[model samples]
Target: MHRQIAGKLTGPVTKWIVLVGAIVLVGIMAPLNGKLIDVQNNEASSWLPQSAESTKVVEQLTGTVDPNDIPTLLVYHRDSGLTTADLAAMDEDAKEIEQIKGVTAQGAFSPNEAKALIASGAKVPPLLSDDDKVAFVAFTFNFGKNGWQDIPDAADKVRELSKIDGVDVHLAGFGGQASDASEAFEGIDTNLIFITLLVVIVILLFTYRSPVLWVLPIISAGFSYMISGGVVYLLAKYADLTVNGQSQSILGILVIGAGTDYALLLIARYREELRRHEDRHEAMAFALHRAAPAILASAATVVIGMLCLVFADLNSTAGLGPVLAVGVGVTFLIMVT
Candidate 1:
C-alpha cells in the first residue's frame, strides 16, 4: 500500500509537482525565521504557574503596585573609602542616568538619611558595605508594557554614563537581568542556525561519504527548521502561545537533528534500492515504501511525547509542546516527501 502511494507520488511528472510545491512552501516560510523571537514571552510571570504564591503575588502587584515601574539597582564600588569627590561624582552619575530615555533614576540615600535611620535604630539597606568599599544607586522605570524591551538600551546608557575615574559601576536587579538576557539572545536566530547547520553538514559529510548527498539532507533540514519557525511564530502571534528563548532555540536543534535522522535513513534505503533498480524514481519509491513506517513511527512517538507537555503547569513547558511538535512534524513531512 505504501509502495503504491510512493510510486504515484514519486512518478516522473509527480516529482516535479512535489519539487515546485516544496520550493513554494520554503520560499513563503524563509522570511519568518527572523520573526520567531518577536512573539517570545520572556517575562517571568508568563512562565510561573498561576496557583503559585509568587505568581499570585506578581498578579496582585501587576496593577496595584509598581504597575508600570521596573526596579533597577546600580552598584558602585572602590577599594578605598569613597572620597568627597567620589560622592559628588556618584550624585552626578545618578543625575545623568535620570536623563536616559525610558528610565527614571533615583538619587542614592543621602548622609542625612543614613544618620536618621541609624538614630531610629533601623537597619538601613547596606548600600555601603561594612568595609565602605561599596555603595549603590536604586531607581525605577515606568516604561509600561514595553519596559522590558527598553531594559537593554537603558542599561547600556546607564553603564556608559555612570563611569567614574576610580569607581566601578554595575547594573543589577531585574533590568540588569533583562539586559543580560537580551545580550544572550542578540544573534540567536543566525548563530544557532549557522552552528547547527555547520555541525550537521560535518556529520552528514562523514556519514554519506558523498559531497552531493550531504547537501540534500542539509537543505531539507534547513527547510524543516524554517517551516517550524514560521508555524511556531504564527501560533505564538495569533493563538497567544507562549514562546521563549529556550523553547525557540531547542526547536531549531530538534528540527535539524530529527530531519537529518529521517533523511539519513531514507537516503540509505534509497541507495540500497538504487543498486537493485535502474530508475531513480523507482528506487526512491521502494525506499520510501520500506523506510517510511519506521520513520513515521519514530516521529509520531516524539511528536506525541512532546505534545504531552501541554499538560504542564508551567507556561514554558506547555509552550514547548506545540513548538517542538511542530518542529518534528515539519521535519517528518519534509523528509518523507
Candidate 2:
C-alpha cells in the first residue's frame, strides 16, 4: 500500500504540495505557541520567591551570604560614630535606588525617632560588627525575582556610594549573584541564538537548493514551534511548571532541531518517491506512509529522553521536563498530520 502511493507523483507537483502543507501547519501553530510561553513566564515569575522583602532580608542577615543577593540588614552604630555627612550620603543612596523598577519598597537605617523602639532595650549594638569593621546598612529593597534584574548595576552603584573612605562595606545576599550571571551572559546568548539561526538557514538552503523545497522545512517547523508552545503554556497552567529565561533557549533548540528533522525525513521520502514514480498524489501518500514510522519512533525516543529529565533534582528543570516533553510530542503529531 505504501509503495503504491509512491508510484503516483511525477516531479514538480510533488514538491509543491509538500511545500504548501508545511506552511499550513506552521500557520496553525504560531499564535497558540506565543500565548503559551507568555503565560508560562508570567506564572513562574509570580509564584515562587513569594515574599520578596523577607527574602531580601533573609539574604542580608546570614553569615557568609553571597553579596550578589538582596538582604535586609539591621545596620546600626553609635550616633556619634556616624558623621552627619555620612548620614546624608546614606539617604541619597536610598533615594537613587528608588528610581529603579521592580523595587516594591525601600527604606534605610535611621534611629527610631519613636521613643518606644529606643526604649525597647533590644540593644541596638553600636559599632554593629566586630572591631568596628563591618556593619549592615539597614534598608531593605522592595524587590522580587524580577527586581533582581536590576540588581547588578544597582549593586555596583550602591557600592560606589556605600563605602566612603574609612567605612568598610560588605554586601552579602542571595538574589544578586544570579542576576549578575544573567546580565553577564546576556550578550553571549543573543549572539549564539542569532548565529545558530543563520547556520540553520544556510544549511537548509544548501541541502535543498530550491527555494520551494527549503520552504517545506521552514513552514513545517514553524507550525511545530507554535503548537509546541501551546502545549507548554497549557501544562504550565495545569501542572507545576517553571519557565525561566532558559525556557527560550530550550524551546528554540527543540523547535529548530526537531522541526527540521521531521521535515527532512518526510521530504527525503517524498523526493525519493518523486524520483521513483510519476504521479503526485501517489508520491505524497508513499512519502507520508514511509516517513510516518520513523518520525514516530524518533519522536517517541525524544519523549522518553525528556521524561528522564522529570526526575532531575532541580525543581525548575523537573517542572520544565514534562512541559518540554509534551511540546515535542505535540510537534511530532503535527508533523505526521
TM-score of each predicted structure versus truth: 0.87, 0.66
lDDT of 1 by residue, 1-337 (tens): 2778999888999988987998898888878867787677777877888678898887888787865566778888888876667766766776777777876544345333454578899987645567777777777766765654667777888898788888877889777877888887776856887898899999988888887989888888888888888988889889988998889889988898999899989999999999999999999999999999999999999999999999999978988899999999999998888
Question: Which digits, one per residue and each the tens of the lDDT, describe model 2 over residues 275-311?
Answer: 8777756666778878878888888898899889766
Best by lDDT: 1
**Global lDDT of each model?**
0.82, 0.59
Kindly give the stretch of ten consecutive residues in candidate 1 with the minimal lDDT sum.
105-114
Model 1 collision count: 0
In angstroms, give how far residue 49 of model 2 lies from its true place. 16
